[model samples]
Target: MADTLVAHHPLEFVVSELSAASGSAVTLTPEPFLPQHIVRLPAGSATAAVAAQLQLPTAANTWSRTADGRAIWLGPDEWLLVGSESTDAAASAARERELLDLVQTVGGAVTDVSAQRLGIRLGGPKARTVLAKGCSIDLHPKHFGIGTAVQTVLGQAGVVLLALPPGADGHPEYLVLVRSSFAGYLATWLLDAALEFTSSSSAAR
Candidate 1:
């Protein structure tokens, strides 16, 4: 018999509602669920071994991506490994376990945080402006450009903000990672902030 398959995505119920409110100046999309492996290596240990197992960046707040997965450096010894959700569920699960095993080999601790966090993609011409309504960071291009990632608060919710490379039309895109519990609140806050921009863009056209 084939293995039983189960699907779970925290943002499933609200994604459609949020997407409906998206507009030209600022579009929001719930990122497809992905497997996330978070690891914490021992202090003073050789990170090269861990990096060898998973292509992780040594610098803080930086991320490295390979064909199979992406790794984000959260702190001196903390890293988050994320696998592409576009792959088959079984393959993604296998990859997550493989990554966890590799971390164990390096004497590091790993946890599967796939369901603990939710992702939202906020993109378009007014993307930055929308985020600025809540975040206090200086999001100017020179200060927070591509590859930059930071933990910040957005409308009372803690989130990891990643500055993704601009889209083909030169519009900025930001990937916001928030706790599953706060996903709804953040989504609503974001949609509210984007309303003015969308309206102005429509009126100008």
Candidate 2:
């Protein structure tokens, strides 16, 4: 028989889906199934397709983006390509396949890791403060400003933390990608820390 098991996202059971506190100065919201592929770049036309300035972004810890997706520079000859958020599994898989084929045409090795991590959207004025409670990385703007992305430790979990441009409210925003197994713990930790900021949304634990 074919496999019958269906995969479920880590934050699926959370009643509130979005947690906010301190008059929205801090917020943690689930952003699941943002298709992603880890690519080991091979010299070819595919690189040009994804490159921002006719070549992959040369700046360390930066990302090259287009309207549909973005390629985050992860390391030497490697990048994480992220597609627009998608709730439909089929669509997500199609997008991943499209990218995989595109890269393979240039002999690049690309792995679909779309289900490997759970995404948490963190933002607001007190966002840095909440993250600082557990993350050791300097959250100061001069050190980790918008457009910066790094693989780091966050609240006892290994995560890819990306500093995004400010939100519509003109406050800082970030995207936290942690392994699914660690999502619950990270969510709880964030909520507890957000307490000081008048935690109110209560998305998960």
Give the range where candidate 2 is weakest over 10 consecutive residues by summed lDDT: 14-23
Could you estimate the TM-score for every candidate?
0.86, 0.83
Alpha-carbon lDDT of model 1? 0.80
lDDT of 2 by residue, 78-128 (tens): 888777666556777676677667666667677877777877888889989
Pick by lDDT: which candidate is best?
1
Q: Which residue pairs clash within candidate 2?
A: none
lDDT of each: 0.80, 0.76
> Candidate 2 clash total?
0
lDDT of 1 at 86: 53
lDDT (0-100) at residue 170 of candidate 2? 90
Error of 1 at 85 (Å): 1.7
Model 1 Cα lDDT, one tens digit per residue, 104-188: 7668787778777778998889899999999999999899888888888998899999888887668989999999889888988
List all candidate RMSDs to the true structure: 3.2, 3.9
Residue pairs clashing in model 1 are none
Candidate 2: stretches off by over 4 Å? 1-7, 15-22, 43-56, 199-205
